[model samples]
Target: MLKISEVCCEDEYDSMKNYEKTPVLMKRAPFWSGAAVQNAKLVNISMKDFINKYMVLIFYPYDFTIVCPSELIQFSDRFEEFQDLDSELIAVSTDSQYTHLAWTTTPRQNGGLGGMNIPILSDKNHRISKRYGVLDEELGVPHKAIFIIDNKQILRHVSTSDMAISRSVDEVLRVIKACQFVDKYGNVCPMRSPCDDDTCESKNTKDND
Candidate 1:
């Protein structure tokens, strides 16, 4: 497990902390006013369409890379699991749509994803990544980040990993399940008995009638 401190330097850590507490109203997802990706054909994703739907926006450093393919293939193979949870997955990269299309058409046996079912959005201008604060300006590539948005379009969870490490798909599913459980139950489900925690003295208290 990569510790938070290991993932970010001190300055980055401070900036992230400030970003968390800052009271800025985020411009909602699907912020395109007029200019959208060409081809309406390029993944053809629109924010309005995804509103009121659970979404997972995953960013990779770039395409046609070794570690990236492994992760992308696994995610694509398990894409149906996400759909079963009422969530849509969209992968993003700093590469242009042209690159994405070319790669998608290439055969997986030849090291390409090959007719992937999911939409691979192009962040060629880096606008979306900058908005999400995941762009690495120095490298001109996005940090590996995953954003989980609820049906309300609120950003519920954010997880980022270093370029070399791949995130666990199981953990992603667990988070979605946890979020859904909370949404339905109005409280977080305890993984174990409350009495298991020594600090939870209230668990042992008896009601006096």
Candidate 2:
């Protein structure tokens, strides 16, 4: 197995066409996840499973890295916050399950995931990351990508950022809240949304600017 410092070679799936893909409702996402046993423990992570709720997928390039750990821990820290909003968060990368397990067992002070229980999907072949169009062929890793899938499994929001910058978990939650708000009220959610949450107030200022 290759270590984190080793760069990956370019492969067949290095096309830009797959990025920002919009999936049809009830369609199964093209990837396998969960603990990788000898047979690869694939989860039934279909669009149908998350009905009447929301789904958030964060795609990072590799595991046991700097920005990645910070982002994953933050999501794990706020896992219940997402749950409270009837949403699920799934983190993915091009690393294998064994790699994920090793990293998760490592502590945050040691630059690891600090034993986060959030489902970290393994895409060792970059098949899933490429299908979602988050892979970076040059670096052989996925981009800092965040995707919001609605309860019906339709791909609603897709955005990417530099790997050097860690994403704001609060921003992600705010967007999901807005998505939910729109679904229920059928009107645009104000940037501030009248919510008393600290994230709401701070994010609103940025939203307006």
Candidate 3:
């Protein structure tokens, strides 16, 4: 297991404070993106460089598997909606770029990604997975994890699931919307079930009670 303590250097805050334990959202991590079957290309995308909008990096164990493709496809299906809100969705795994390319070329019925518009990053080194604290100790691979980073380069949210269970893109979108709402209005979003309709704009923040 990757310890958070090992990754921490020095944290900056609005005020100077001494702390033995590292505070979350104060450290920057780098990740590689652009590893898609459509293109066997790799580009270094650092969290430090992203200034505005949000990023959703969903990590799965590997490519060409039972659950990974569906998750990637589902996100890809809803790609433009996220883009309209100024968000980028990235699927990641500890697989080689060649494997990723092959899987994307294969058809979905044939148990491959077929083709996904969103960037499927190849974290062959597992550096981002470990840095984000989602690395599986035994297999030395990433578990099902989704990291939501704000435009300010701060990690805003994290959700993880087991290998057998697939994740919900709707839930991830809801969280991202909530984060955006709060960031914009400075009010917490109401605790409600994710709305299936396009009325996400009507969400209201809870008032003092």
- Stretches of candidate 3 off by over 4 Å are 1-50, 192-209
Cα lDDT tens digits, model 2, 91-113, are 88888778877787777788777
lDDT of 3 at 4: 34
Q: What tens digits encode model 1's per-residue C-alpha lDDT throughout 160-209?
A: 88999888887787777767765654445456432234423433342221
Clashes of each: 0, 0, 0
Question: Model 3 over residues 18-131: C-alpha lDDT tens digits?
Answer: 321222562443333333443444454433333465788888998777777877889998989888778988777888778887888888888987767777777776655665
What TM-score would every model get versus the actual structure?
Answer: 0.74, 0.73, 0.74
Q: State each model's CA lDDT, in order.
A: 0.67, 0.68, 0.67
Best candidate, lDDT: 2
Cα error, candidate 2, residue 168 (Å): 0.4
Best of the two (1, 2) by TM-score? 1
lDDT of 2 at 175: 85
Clash tally for model 1: 0
Model 1 poorest 10 in a row by lDDT = 31-40
Which runs in model 2 stand beyond 4 Å of their true positions? 1-51, 194-209
